[model samples]
Target: EPEVTQTPSHQVTQMGQEVILRCVPISNHLYFYWYRQILGQKVEFLVSFYNNEISEKSEIFDDQFSVERPDGSNFTLKIRSTKLEDSAMYFCASSGLRSTGELFFGEGSRLTVL
Candidate 1:
């Protein structure tokens, strides 16, 4: 089955540095989302995008975080500045439709800030 794939499965960066987490969601899915798990915490929603526009975003997705579908198949999340608190396993997900609430998540990109 098709699935989401993320690059740089694990990344270590210094505080104040910038990081870009990339993902290619399922080709047929219509909705994409970025979620994060801070170490042992439960998954938290960061933002949702559809049709090249942001549909909704969480408070956690503040000025520092941005999302884009730069091309047809690739979706991306960019952190303007890395912070210790930003360390987490970021997941890229997609669903065939929004009402289903069923998301297929990627392996996740682990970000570790020093």
Candidate 2:
């Protein structure tokens, strides 16, 4: 089965630096989303995209963060400036429907901000 894949499963970065987390969603899915989980916390939605435009974004997706579909297979999230609060497991997910479908997630790209 096709699955979402993320690179650099773990990353350690200093505060105030830039980071780009990469993901490749399932080939046939149309909607993609990014969620973050702070240690021992609930998963929070950051952004959702479809048809090359943002479908929805939460308050957590602020000016410092951006997402792009740079190619047919790759979706990327870029943080212009990282912060200590940014340390979390970033999950990339895809689903066939936006409202009522299960999301398939990557193992996660763990970010450690110090």
Candidate 3:
């Protein structure tokens, strides 16, 4: 079975630094998303991309955050400036349909902001 893969399972960065988390979602999936979990907090949606454009995004995806599908097989999330509160486990997900309620997720890239 195909699955999402993320690079750098763990990352530690200082405050105000830039961070880029990478992911390769299943090839056949059409929609992709970035979600984050702040330690013990609930999972929060950051952004979604489809057809090479941003489909939707949450308020947490502020000016500092950006998503891109730079090629045929990769999806990426970039945080221009990291903050202490930005430390979290970022998950990359893909699905065939938004209403299907089923998303395939990666193991997650952990980001630690000092």
Candidate 3 has an lDDT of 0.96
Flag regions of model 2 displaced more than 4 Å. 97-100
Worst 10 residues of 2 by lDDT: 94-103
Task: Tell me how candidate 2 scores on lDDT.
Answer: 0.95
How many clashing residue pairs, candidate 2?
0
Please give the distance, in angstroms, between residue 30's alpha carbon in candidate 1 and its true position after superposition.
Answer: 1.1
Model 1 steric clash pairs: none
lDDT of 3 by residue, 37-96 (tens): 999999999999999999999999999999999988999999999999999999999998
All candidates' lDDT scores? 0.95, 0.95, 0.96
Model 1 TM-score, all chains together? 0.96
What candidate 1 gets wrong by more than 4 Å, as runs, is none
lDDT of 1 by residue, 1-114 (tens): 798999889999999999999999999998999999998899999999998899999999999999988889999999999899999999999999657878999999999999
Off by over 4 Å in 3: 97-99
- C-alpha lDDT of residue 106 in model 3: 99
Report the C-alpha displacement of residue 68, candidate 2, in angstroms: 0.3
The pairs that clash in candidate 3 are none
